[model samples]
Target: MAASMWRKMRTYVSRKNIHRLIFDPQCAIFSMFLLLIAEVAVNILVIKKIKYTEIDWKAYMQEVEGVVNGTYDYTKLRGDTGPLVYPAGFVYVYMALYYVTSYGHHIRLGQYVFALLYILSLVILFDIYRKTKRVPPYSFIFMCCASYRIHSIYVLRLFNDPVAMFFMYVAINFFLRDRWSIGCLMYSFGVSIKMNLLLFSPAILMLLMVRFGTLKTLLHLIVCAVPQIVLAVPFLLENPVGYVVRAFNFGRQFFYVWTVNWRLIPEEIFLNKYFQTALLILHVTFLILFFVFKWRRLYPGVGFGILMKESPTALSPNQILLPLFTSNLIGMSFSRSLHYQFYVWYFHTLHYLLWSTTQPPIVKILVLGVIELCWNTYPSTVLSSSLLHVCHAVLLYGLWYSPDYTPNDKNLTATKVD
Candidate 1:
């Protein structure tokens, strides 16, 4: 009887039925339950070792309360504390949390809520991949079981990166379905949460323009701007310049030790204004060259035919561009004063991009295993700055070279799996 049952189970899990097993609600539920337990264990370990107060949760709470009470002064905040760089929508999230936690006195409650949100974000991400039907077998499972480096940054450290990434993922999901307006709104909301998202704005706008044409794209952009405008009304009326300068220009230079590249360069280089200017110009030129060459190879269009041809569908251009843009942004962030927790931003994008490819399951597993090793070593002394720089460079290069599946592909059938 035992031998017969084993044979039956093996037969049931064959390639043809794998999809059913993978997407089954019961499977997802069980995976999530396991993930929750693991995450809770990790969170407990981190909080105990690092100490809750050292992570800046209290300062973040104070900042949010300050914004809610209308006593928030941007200029003063930036001067006295570090940059108050997050968007108004982020403030709202914190405010809601504060209200529920009774002004953050209930730290455990806040941590629990963030933990749940982090888990929910992963579920939504899996749903988005499942909707594509192109997600390789075991991809979602790998993502769930991967190291805590990225997810912990949000859940344990209590940062807004996860929340912003959630919006980005939602926006991409809507965009994939050709829901341009809603996607644009979500994109706008993501940007409103953190200016880091501004890096993706141009790509999102390009996507809208390609999908809806110029006039309609402009109208959609206007509509998308409404939410941000409404949220900024008070700040705009009070001290527009201060808000703009603080929110936009907060990270204009490098000062912190946690920033990645800054640690590599000499202090003299960072202190010199001209050196910074030169580095900025060099970085911009390199990125432009990379994109130009990439585009020329991937999609070469005739004059009028370009507008008429359908946009790339194997993961929209935005999906392809986002990971690259985010990697570069993380590089830039590291070149400035990046906190240890800020590494979450890059790892999240990197891990997602790795799993999203059409590569074989073994290849995905191998790559993720390497990344997991690196991530696990990050907090320890084993992973040095030079090692991290190389890893990041490799991931960014992979992102740039990875196929995003344009509509121009001859093999793409009418089923449209992307």
Candidate 2:
């Protein structure tokens, strides 16, 4: 059975395709048009003056002033009190921007740089979609450019998300290419900037364990973790207790009514120490279970030595990428709290997970539509949040279960991770 599944996976990836628009030049144009549409939408928001003060842009600009003054302390941040919620690695980006221009150019400079990073991420995503040969090229582009979260990354909330996300995109791109070491290194940088980047860490662990083995995976994890530890050093030196508390404050909860998730859930549950703890335990348990099931199911009757000799899947890491992405997403989907900007974390990845499924096209469309609606709405209603949560479970469960073997399928499942 193990040999047969491996053979089946091999044949599936090797099958040929004859799609005309897969690599057509106009596909790029269509992608750009979708981005333009999102830009127009953001411009409309700018005109309304709705996003300027409330969007976190003003706060971001203030944070950079910390760099300009020679104190790199995050405690100086405006709006929010105490030390910065972001990791110290982000200071590197602001520090560079600080030397380049005057105070007046801070926000705009940050915007332009972050926008470019986001564009680069999109370009890489476009390439991944194009290579998949499983989904309509146009559909993936629409999801990428049409997202409100994507719009916010560039036009509204000017935080370190895009920069951290840029490293994630780069890491995934390298993973797709079978440069496992390089990919893991790049992933370290993303995690260093923001621990959220570690959402994909479970998937990476699975990949490393499969492609290398238990011992090598341990080594890779050490390699990946070193950077995160190093990045925290400066902040740790300034105020060890404060930095650790602020940086890894997993216990800290949010009650921002503006957030989409948990609005309908009684604030009592959100504040309930036990409920939050259960969710964290569940999150860790979920990853371990997913990893075990996948390992047993895919490599049945095979030992680690033989497994590493030849990957069961035909493609190098394509099968790994889909689940790697979705598994991490599964962690986020069940998060105790998800903020508005946090939606940016999964917008494109969820779309990719959607494409990986063998579910009916309409179902896929509705799932994406529901997720888009949930995030796009400000102060999301209970109805949309419920829909978003359900669809996330449905989409992730779909992506988590099987890598659709159909030639038209690009999504990796239990068989492949997208």
Candidate 3:
């Protein structure tokens, strides 16, 4: 009787059915929920153990207030030395928050709001992954279990980056859907939130030119600039040069102790004015090389026609979405001033890329494992600045090239037909 029962059970569980079960969305959702719970527990521990009172709540509150009241002066707020740093649209979001909270007194309330944004970002990331056809269920599960949630917690204390990342993802979503005009508008909104995104503007322009051709692309680009122009009209009229200087040149003037790469090299070398000039030149040169030499050849027009040749059933919209997503993630990694929370933006992108590739499973696991470990260490405060910077630079550089040479087609289809 026992042998008969075992045979029946084995017959009922077919190999094909088991494979289907493994890849099911229900399984993925359950796994993500458990991972989220674990992450929240860890965050609670980190917040409780750390001295939360050490944060500059008063200064943050004052900035929040300044952003709410349009009358608040940037020069006075920055002490006449620092640039405005943030774009004007950020003030609008803060103003909305202020109104909602009725200008709440407690700083912890602001922290909680930031935390909710972090959670919303995670949900957006999952949507990006689900929309990408080439991504595998297993890979998505791995991302859910990774260090992305931990990084979000670190960003919760610093509100600006979370808001910036949210807008960046919004821009990416629009771009994926072939809405270039809307994408550009979202990109402008993102830059307004944080000037750091300006680094990726060149890449954005290149993508627009490629997708829409010359005249139309130029027109769209101009349209996108409208927001910035309107926001700056007041400052521009008051002092054009000063406004330009504050908007563009301010970040270049001051060096922060928390800057990652500066600590890696010799202090004397990093401190020299010539060193900054040389570094700027080097970064620009490499960025140009990436676009002109490496990226151009990787796409369809440059003789990789075989790679670009669409699958018989593949939708053009899907084909376009993959590249759009790739460009955004690569752009973010190349950006300067990438704080810890910015990792949330790329988690889904990384998973999609990994799932689409044909690389051995072991290699994927190793690379992702290392990335998670590095992201988790960042908020620990145990690692030296030099080490953190080195790790960040290396990981980002590695990620940019990883999907380029791989042979996965998960991102090539509009939807999973199987």
Name the top TM-score candidate. 2
Candidate 2 residue-wise lDDT at 245: 66
TM-score of each: 0.76, 0.79, 0.72
The whole-model C-alpha lDDT of candidate 2 against the native structure comes to 0.65
TM-score ranking, best first: 2, 1, 3
lDDT for model 3 comes to 0.55
When summed lDDT is taken over every stretch of 10 residues in candidate 3, the lowest stretch is 305-314
Which is the better candidate, 1 or 3, if ranked by TM-score?
Answer: 1
> lDDT tens string, model 1, 319-379?
4344345434534533444455555555445545654455555665676666555445533
lDDT of each prediction vs. the true structure?
A: 0.59, 0.65, 0.55
Model 2 per-residue lDDT tens digits across residues 291-407? 666534443433654335435443344465565776668777778877777776777776567766768778887887777788777777778778877987897678656554333
* Residue 200, candidate 3: C-alpha displacement in angstroms: 3.1
For model 3 the TM-score comes to 0.72
Extract clashing residue pairs from model 1: 259-338, 260-334
